[model samples]
Target: MTLLKGWRYGAFVGFIAGFIGATLYPIVISPMINSDYYKQIQKETRAGVNQEEIQPGNMKVWSDPFDRKK
Candidate 1:
């Protein structure tokens, strides 16, 4: 009985640890690993935007198809 109880407790702790690691890896570790790629994408997106022309009401509404050309 004692041996069975110890095995059960160990299994429970192992499962909890695995779950926490899986949850945190995507939110924390993955970003650090891909930080350079993320920075590059951010730079490219910002470079294409015209900062001065962006305003609250100075926007155009598009239809469902969005068939308009620039």
Candidate 2:
């Protein structure tokens, strides 16, 4: 019924808690933390502006670190 009320049960509970946390993170936590098109309008606005409109070296930038460098 009870968990022995010491480090052993605490560790077991902690393990279960961490397991549940890791398991639920992708399902329950990731979606809320992710963003989809939240700043699309601003991005498109920047992208539409030409070099004359925006300064150099600040063009519409999209970088994915997972991809290789140019």
- Root-mean-square deviation of every model: 10.9, 7.5
Model 2 C-alpha lDDT per residue in residues 23-51, reported as the tens digit of each score: 99988787667645446656877775666
| Tens-place lDDT digits, model 1, residues 30-51 | 9999899899989988897765
Indicate the TM-score of model 1: 0.58
lDDT of 1: 0.83
Alpha-carbon runs more than 4 Å astray in model 2: 1-5, 37-70
Task: For each candidate in the order shown, give its overall lDDT on alpha carbons.
Answer: 0.83, 0.75
Poorest 10 consecutive residues by lDDT, candidate 2: 33-42
Steric overlap count per candidate: 0, 0
Model 2: pairs clashing at backbone N, Cα or C within 3 Å: none
Which TM-score value belongs to model 2? 0.43
- TM-score of each candidate? 0.58, 0.43
Clashes of 1: 0
Q: Pick the TM-score winner.
A: 1
